[model samples]
Target: MSRPNILIYMTDQEQAQVSFPEHPCLMPRTEQFAGEGVRFRNAYTVAAHCCPARASFMTGLYPSRHGVYNNVNTHTAIHRGLNDGVITFSELLSEAGYRMLFSGKWHISNHENPCDRGWEELIVSSPGDRQSGIPPTARWEEAAKVSNDTRGRGQILRPGWGHYLVYDTYPDQGPKGYENDRDYQFVTAAKEVLPDLTESDTPWCLYIGPNGPHDPFNIPERFADMYDPDQIALPPSYHDQMEDKPRIYQRQRSQYWDQLSEAEVRESIAHYWGYCTMMDEMFGEVLDALEASGAAENTLVLRMSDHGDYCGAHGLYCKGVPAFREAYHIPLMARWPKGIVQPGRDSDALISIMDIAPTLLDLADIGPIPEGVAGRSLTPFFNESSPTSWRDTLYTQFNGVELYYTQRMVQTQTHKYIYNGFDFDELYDLVQDPHELTNVSDRPEYQDIKQDLVRRMWRTALAEKDIISNPYATVAMAPWGPGIAFE
Candidate 1:
């Protein structure tokens, strides 16, 4: 029998709920994919930013182990490169005689490129302003300096307004123009690659990662008109002031909130939804191509995102600080017609993006992941016999000096605990405080609850080796605090 093909479809910054039945975004194609597969309702990204989360997904290890802790950090080998001796899922599959191809964004390294890491073919975008038009050498040098800032390291700087030329093709500028155009090009690339299928004897692993619905909030004209700005509802946690919360959260709100008005926020969200819808359309084309190539039934399809976007939720504009569900929880759907025992079922069990590697290996009937890989295979879940051991809590961490400093969180089905090394601590019963507006950490009534959560937080850190000693332990909050206040 021929080996099964694998297609991992991913989006940059998408919230898990956007594809939910009630979300404002109409994703009929995605909904159809979910209906044909198993959807993981509580899936989360290990880290709430791009690079680290992507690294974890690729390596099946936590960020701390991989050493790509933030988006701006440039130590690519294990830091920039995949950690020394670490076996990437793609590398393993390639060694097993599979064709591995990577298309779209490759933010893993400043020095080493993704193609060197076992991807036989690569079509990618560099980090930073997508339209800067700077040469790779100059762009890397400039990016390195900017990332040296205490907080900016390891994060992709927001793009400025201009014509974005994707992979040196398709110049897109202005609202409702660039994002959709880029999606069109991505779809076109996938279509063009289909002819290669017949020439190869080995099965393939194709990763299509689109950078959309992430920022610049642009969409096609028709898609932008899908929803009225006035009809969009702001999240319940959208407070005018951060009040009694961590100082980092307040700082971030001040920086980005003013750039948008109430109407603009809604419009941005509507455009974001439009971008997601466009992504769905692009994915549908890919699915059709798979079927046309006679590769549909033999291929395992997995769709997910790097991380969730805030997109005006909790009075915040983007993802960085504030590790809320809107920023950490992401949509995950898997379909393997040859392996899945049940279709169209939903699993609420906790899972993370890192699990993708092991699951892929499992579907291939490969042996255990080399020792040291932290993620577990999800094969048993698809088989309808729940795994004997599964994680009950999910964790995320962020380290940004400008927006925040070293914040970590532990999320369970009923509650969430946020530990900020710099400022106030927070705990919330997600069931009672779904929006996470109320902080129950200091409340006397929840004292026992708080202690239990703290223990879990520490346990997770220790298990994942994510803990770091406070380097600035002596710095107290100055009366006025440090840095210029926007307000």
Candidate 2:
């Protein structure tokens, strides 16, 4: 019941379905530890993009509250930082006398690094990399040159724009070790820090973030070869064609992804799954380090991802304008050997990634996170008590990935509705068409359903004080306006 050491491992662009007990993605470490902790089957990110979702995780507030809805990287950003007066949970931990150590990606805000938020930065993909002072990795020179057959399977050549490659092998890698990879470097740093943590008197918190299995699923040949593309099958939704969905969804497909032949699509999935396997291996190494540190029995180990990847679902690669569940559903797992009553359990209770901040504070017996925060502590789910007051609806507040489009979503167990201010709206019967192959927003029978969802959307949007919750005559779009919430 005392303060426990916190060890967090957050991956990038990984979907929640992959961590299901029945999922096909091969993750040996996850499988081994499957019953050692709790697996949240309904976990989700508030936004699909990294910065907004990560900010939600760090602050327990949605993108609108945190004021970051797009990528916060230096080169290609519009709104490049979090809103003023934002307080990350790390700052609270630091005030409570915990040593916060971090390595790998921290895209929450480009204005300042994790150190500015209370963490001691460490490793190659250091949190400091988010700041403009750090040099970016050189890719322009390599992308401009005319390519031959030397291009890897993942490479998508662009004459002017930088070449897009999500999967590739390293020159230093054969089949055994991956010394040159960024993920390995980050994990190694976390591993090195674990030993020193055991000697310290302070209850510490260490965060390891790896930008992998994300895009350009770069890995060794050994990992990619693990899944034969021939045996892989396309997603059930791959043939949807998006004829019933929004036009922007169709445009995204036709412009970029639809070019891939069925063979290529299958190959892309194989590479993504293989990259997942590589991530699992890297995760195991950190767990091994924790075991060696002699704090394995008391440390609170967490495995989560910033958001989900399309990964060939609906003929898309990465997360973007789409409102598909493949892009929003995220993986979250937790293990606390000395604290949790039962190590092995899966909870179907609805939960958000933002809930992480307050959950940690609750577990540590620290003061609750700032009032008015969107996320409530998930302590009941962790304890397997399933609080009766838990929320049923999970909402998404998205602006855009890089482009600007105002969007909001509200989803229940059986139905989902997306309010897009840019174009049209969307509604889906999750029970009837689980793959989201059909859009029911335009159907006469579903009009009532749409209205019901719209009312809920407005209610939550108003409560959250979302930026898009405007009453302007032109932008106050949606078949049922904000006034419907009162009706």
lDDT (Cα atoms) of all candidates against the true structure: 0.67, 0.77
The regions of model 1 sitting more than 4 angstroms off are 72-81, 127-180, 198-201, 401-487
lDDT of 2 by residue, 6-29 (tens): 999999988777777687888879
Each model's TM-score, in the order given? Answer: 0.72, 0.79
- C-alpha RMSD in Å of predicted model 2 compared with the true structure: 12.9
Q: What lDDT does candidate 1 reach at residue 6?
A: 87
Model 2 lDDT, residue 473, Cα: 19
Question: Model 2 reaches what TM-score against the true structure?
Answer: 0.79
Q: Report the Cα lDDT for candidate 1.
A: 0.67
**Model 1 per-residue lDDT at 160:** 16
Colliding pairs, model 2: 166-216, 166-217
